[model samples]
Target: MTIEQMKRNARDKIINEIAFLAGGLTSACQVRAIICAYLYVDLVSDAEYREYCDLILQVENKRISQSDF
Candidate 1:
């Protein structure tokens, strides 16, 4: 699959795992384990992750500013 497709699939899997944790079918320890596994599979470096995080924060700030007006 393409990079975009892989990202989407990874995101979906993470969401599902979080939901399972929330539902108590999975323990907190299990959730942490899964998160570690996901992080390893993510492959993105710290710099790339930081850049994407900053972009998301910027978008969120802009949305909040617009809503306040």
Candidate 2:
């Protein structure tokens, strides 16, 4: 599949996982957790896009790891 397709799939998976987790819990913590998961997915998508661009640049450069950045 294409990069864009992969990104969409990843996002859908993240949302499904978050929904499952949220379904098991109650109160404000659930909302917080869902928000965090959403943000995490967004970051993942952004990082993927950045890396794609970096590759297109065709220059040797170090990019921060997702866990570290």
Report the alpha-carbon TM-score of model 1 versus the true structure.
0.51
Q: Can you tell me which runs of candidate 1 are displaced by over 4 Å? A: 43-69
Q: Write the per-residue lDDT of candidate 2 for residues 1-69, one digit (tens) a residue.
A: 876676677556545544443344333344335445545656355565444334323221222233246
lDDT value, residue 63 of candidate 2 = 20
Name the weakest run of 10 consecutive residues (lDDT summed) in model 1: 48-57
lDDT of 1 by residue, 42-61 (tens): 73445544554454445445
Score candidate 2 by lDDT. 0.45
Candidates in order have lDDT scores of 0.55, 0.45
